[model samples]
Target: MEQTNQIERKLKLMHVVAIGLAYMSPMAVFDTFGIASDISSGHVPAAYIVVFVAILFTALSYGKLVRQFPSAGSVYTYTRNVINPYLGVIVGWVTFIAYIALPMINALLADIYLSAGFPEVPGWLWVVGLIAIITFLNIFGVKIAASVNMLLVIFQALVGVIFAYLTIRSIVKGPESFIPIGDIFPSGGEVPELFGAAALLALSFIGFDAITTLSEDTINPKKTIPKAILLVAGIGGVFFFTVTYFMQSLFPDVSIFKDIEGASPEIAVIIGGNLFLSFFLSGALFSVFASGLAAQLSASRLLYAMGRDGVLPKRFFGYLHPKFNSPVANILLIGVLSTSAIFLSLEAATSLINVGAFTAFSFVNLCVIISFFKHKGPRSFGFTVSSLLFPLIGLAFVVYLWISLDIFSIIAGLIWALLGTIYLAFTTNFFKKEPPQIAFDELEA
Candidate 1:
């Protein structure tokens, strides 16, 4: 069956709004603050400020790319245009893997969050349920997907902003316990170490790119693409920086950090948690649910594009569901892989997430610089400084984070990327692979 291409321009714009905000919603606050605590001691808030600045530079790079080439498949899409198609497929495949890992980790995290209330229910139970809900929304259609995501993002942002406002109010009210702003630069611990720790948490800054993958469904493709990304990062950077500080101020206790008793770093509960933290924890599943929903949408589009381009089997994945106008087969394929990966690495999902993100970020940061250089096509001077210089620094920081990943986490990234290379070779040969699909048809013609 032929794909309808019915995703109207408006829905595409709305998709951008939904995906951009959803990625940075309430769950992200948990993510940022949680990671910050692990690396910065009680000064978790200060760590966010560092990551905020780093990703903010990278966001500028993304903004330039989206303005020039607005299409699905994001990083791979951009890289394919300037470099070899085969190379594009490798980047695309690796990113697809990273995208898949996102949902698995999020769903697993949701399970843990839900465990606080229904101690009897296994976390994977929540994982399964989340998979079903988001998959269905994805299958239903983009209009419904966008609407649901928009509502979810709005709800998440509202609740989070409220939490932020309250945390800020709490800070102003009295001498609540917290790592003061002055404490951001360590008194004795290595500055490089503190920066390294903060870099690891830069994983939270990743959602800014989530907007890029949905380019196939965005409105005013060139205009909205750049604006949405910058907007999300701007909001996310400020939001993360502000909330981490306030959470520390609201409850200055290191009391929450003891005996997490597992692989996952229990960041939030350690920093500013009590019974009230349960409220956020309870609501957290929805945030994770939101992340899975957004990631699935992005990944499936990627999978579909791969099939359409002959890098993957077209017979199975090339066809779209008649009713859903979506790639039901590819969506299910990614969902299953993601679910299996969660259990396969249940012991290591969290660490691997940070590690995989670093790998992808390093690849992307480097890709941007490479793409910037390879572009003989017309590009503004301002674009050069923004995309090139910024990504170089971002790439350096990503490498710094890559080394800091625990031995096990580094092993996981190496193995995953290695496996992806193998899959790319076999699949490319099997499908009689050709060039990467340009996000813009005009670029090729």
Candidate 2:
């Protein structure tokens, strides 16, 4: 067997955090608030609060796993090392679906925003252009992608803060009719319904786990990756909370939005006029573009990890540029696949993306529990809280969210899992042998 080529460690904590933030896309709170508000009956911020707690627990579990086995595969490597390799293969495929779908969704949203601004330009053109730029940067190296993501993330954060300030200013300065604090919680709803709404809001937290995929490329993966995961989740949660609070404040009535998905841009127009509207739209477009870049970068790394492990064709998916130290073929593959978003509506594309993410989230929680039992022996109180209790709580939240997924998403997710099972069966020869493994000693050293 050819020796495994290691990815150079060039990413620091901030770089990983930037990549995570870029993947989360702070401006996403604008794009998703309408659906969340509609579901929660105007309590978008409340839903985010619930989902934030859930994500925090899962992020903790992720941190634990990364400390034990720092690798590029994220959930795939964790599950394979802690559980079974066959199951790991399935997790890898599911994660691939999530990562790939995310970039496509971002690309599609970016194109939609751009087309709204310039109706003369076709949406496909924006999609192609965005994918091409991201592909080029990722193939160059992780640091280049990280630098671009940092700049974009900073710009997006500034836009979000400015929008929130303007929204609050509008409320205080405008007519007394504005209800600033009323819409943060649901007016009237069952607990289960709030949980369901929170489930949808949880999708906004998808990118934090993308940090783990950069483990091989990060400095001190054991420490930096974990800290980045928590920081990303926390920072993103605060962004969601602050922005959604102001968003609901500005547009108190969800019924007014003719198109809930585009409500953020319209809110920008209402609060800050055409200039800020232009700023908001441009910021959103750039934010989603940066997100697509981060998503593609993480997805390629995941593919490279799987390829190196012999779970996939090593010659193609596994090979990195001798100098660039990047999974060039996988980056190109994701770039090509991302353009398919031009054919898909935003709703249809986004629904499919979360299925894999939710699946991986649940499994990662389980992997943490299993690892705790295997390594820690009998659980003490501290172990139970850290390993067993927290993960179980996290799993419960994930299961609730999974059950609440749209019917089409559920059907599609099941079909994807079934396909993965078939592929696994054939690859493993009916589970008679262990899947191929790549030792990490040299890379770790």
Candidate 3:
């Protein structure tokens, strides 16, 4: 086995951009081409406008939060400062689950893609292989991970662009033919149901906030974090809408929801573009690879910070590797939990993940709104309030999306909150005799 060196805090701005890029890839193309197709019914691409606008408000809030704290614990640290301490712990726990669930889904999809090539090899092997590779890179530290992510983001971007451009450019000869600019619209339906369907499918476009989770580790966190987020949303939005529209144009017969093998409507764009199955599968694999790396990197840092705050078991959560300077214990814990989740219920996992991520994103946004009001020093923050409750309106927008999530997701989120509460109570009871607990980093030094 190779011994890893401790990682120095030498990661620069472009590396931070790599983090945003790779982190955005996991579900970016998948949802854009897959999930977006489902609700779009030709109108789904338009919903990108709504999702992008909503994300702008959310990004504004996160930008403010990261500027305040240039340390780890992106959501947890922000929520802790803006809200109650207990709420912070709950937010951390749930976000951990969210982080884990995303990679699990991606890994599963990756394995499925692998299984196609190697019938002799089990799908689980590739999944575990990906985990081990990412874990090793992360333990080596962020800079190396960021370097790998740069290559990955490039690959995903190229594959996606090529797939889209080919489909669009070749539309003249492909089956069903590409719809011109005028074809993007709803045929006929209730306004409420149409919008709701758009919203339901729009959940796929939620990776920009996840990209913001790396805010704590960035150079000039405020400027870098906001730019990375806005970049992800802007680029992701335009790209997603373009491919989805072209795919719809290429396949006039297939409904977005209809499931079929490759060369069908689900994959009509690739099929029409004459892309080999190899490219499609490779792209999916790359998507999940980026997903796993980003999740493990961000989530490990989350645990490291939470432990430092004395919110969890310090021995497990707070222990940093002397040799690697990575949160070894926390990384192992997250890996085990995520691996265990491979066989668990995806519906439950997805719902829980979505709600947890949604809440954190909402809170991060809400905190920004509060921070601006609280510390509006001259030119303090953006946006002038025309109404008495401009802040309230922003807060309400976040909360409404937070509630619109599935009940299963809410229950899962609440369960994690309760667990955090229970653990806090136990720790308080056990440490009753101690005057004060030492910090994790203090123990390390």
* Highest lDDT model number: 2
lDDT of each: 0.67, 0.86, 0.64
**How well does candidate 1 score on lDDT at residue 302?**
78
The sequence of per-residue lDDT tens digits that candidate 2 reaches over residues 105-177 is 8888878778877899988998899899999999999999999999999999899889988988988887624
TM-scores for every predicted model: 0.85, 0.95, 0.84
Q: Rank by lDDT, highest first.
A: 2, 1, 3
**Best-first order by TM-score:** 2, 1, 3
What tens digits encode model 1's per-residue C-alpha lDDT throughout 1-445?
Answer: 5665333334555567677667554465554454455556556666667777777766766776776666666777666665567767777766666677777877777776678678997667777887888888888776677787787777666657667765666666666655555765666755665686576567776677877776666666777777777777777767666766777666445456453222112433333356546555645666777778888888887777677666678767655777767778877887777776446555476665675466556666776788777778878877777678888988877777776778887676668777767887776674476654644664221
Worst lDDT 10-window in candidate 3: 436-445
Q: How many backbone clashes does candidate 3 have?
A: 1
Q: Judge candidate 1 at residue 371 and give its lDDT.
A: 76
**Per-residue lDDT value at 229 in model 2:** 91
**Candidate 3 TM-score to native:** 0.84
Query: Candidate 3 lDDT, tens digit per residue, 1-445?
Result: 3323212455565676666667666334444444444545445555655565665666666665666665577787777666655566667777777777866766676676677778799867877877888888888867778888878878877777767766766676654665655656555663444455445544554556665555444555556766776676677778766766666676554444455223332463445333544575577678778867887888887777777666766667767777767788877777777776558655666686677667776677667666656654554123544111343554565576765687777777788777776776676674352212223232110
Segments in model 2 whose C-alpha atoms lie over 4 Å from true places: 1-4, 176-190, 376-378
